[model samples]
Target: MHRRRELVGWATVGVVLCALAIPWFLWGSSTVVFGLPLWLWWHVGWMVLASAVFWLFARRAWGLGVETADSSERASATASVGDGGGSR
Candidate 1:
């Protein structure tokens, strides 16, 4: 259930990012931010946002389990190796 919620949260973030990337939202704007046109700023902002979202999703969804699984597998393999070449 927790994982499902996390996936849904990520999906919501993806949808928002897609919506923000649509040019219509930034069209007809003459403002400038940080020495860049508004439209360009919008895109740059979204790019940064997308990177952050991806990092969060990767860390939460895959990072922890992969490390734990790898460590346990290594431990089991070492134990088997120590058991003397098994079933010769």
Candidate 2:
């Protein structure tokens, strides 16, 4: 259930990411803003938004779908690092 919920969350984010990948509403429009075409501004703003979304995901949910080592291995790795030994 938890994994399903996470997947759904990611799916929604993915939809938002893809749906705005192109500024379809600005196509064939002659609008300009601050000496730049509106579509170019849309792309610049979209990139900023995408970067923010990715930054938040990296900070909060980076391992959502990643397979990780089991507890014993994680414990050993931590112990090794704690003792100033590199995990081999």
User: In TM-score terms, which candidate is top?
Assistant: 2
Residue pairs clashing in model 2 are none
lDDT of 1 by residue, 1-88 (tens): 3434555776787798888785586578888877988888778877988898788877656543344544544655766644432322
lDDT digits (tens) for residues 24-54 of candidate 2: 9878987989999889888899989999999
Best by lDDT: 2
| Clash statistics: count for each candidate | 0, 0
Relative to the unseen true structure, what is the C-alpha lDDT of residue 83 in candidate 1, on a scale of 0 to 100?
Answer: 42
lDDT scores of the candidates, listed in order: 0.66, 0.73
Candidate 1 yields a Cα-based lDDT of 0.66
TM-score of 1: 0.56
The deviation in Å at residue 58 for candidate 1 is 1.1
How many steric overlaps does candidate 1 have?
Answer: 0
